[model samples]
Target: MDGDFWHGNPKCYRVPKSNVEYWTKKIEGNRARDKKHTKTLKRLGWHVIRIWESALRDEEAVATKIRAAMMRHINGETT
Candidate 1:
């Protein structure tokens, strides 16, 4: 599960008033590293599912997303 804040959730992400630059860089670095890791995982033939921390609050939505991913996998779609 990815932390919404760290991964820069478009819905609820905000840079802190204090240490704004630091937080921005940190989150950006995290996003970059996450992208890299996701690429590596997919290259190694892993089905990647990124469910945000906040998204987990809505169980039905999460389930639907997972089910969609599963269907895509069963249909031999990889990304």
Candidate 2:
């Protein structure tokens, strides 16, 4: 599911949501939090592959990308 920033805000400009939320501004350490969350999920045996909000623009390519992630997850290749 897409977020508010991706859906309308022009500032986002082809950036991933993670990049947008965590990497934007020097407000705080959102990036580090994201890293922690990802690591936590991975440690819990969850395959967590993230796609950029812009990547969804191409439906076919997005499908392929998601499928690849799923394949990797199924194959037990830790993300």
Q: Report the C-alpha displacement of residue 40, candidate 2, in angstroms.
A: 0.5
Pick the TM-score winner.
1
Tens-place lDDT digits, model 1, residues 4-79: 8989987899999999999999999999999999999999999999989999899999999999999999999875
Q: Which residue runs of candidate 1 sit more than 4 Å off their true CA positions?
A: none
Clashes of each: 0, 0
Name the candidate that leads on lDDT: 1
Model 1 root mean square deviation, Cα atoms: 1.0
Q: Lowest-lDDT window of 10 residues in candidate 1?
A: 2-11
Locate the minimum summed-lDDT window of 10 residues in model 2: 1-10
Model 1 clashes, total count: 0
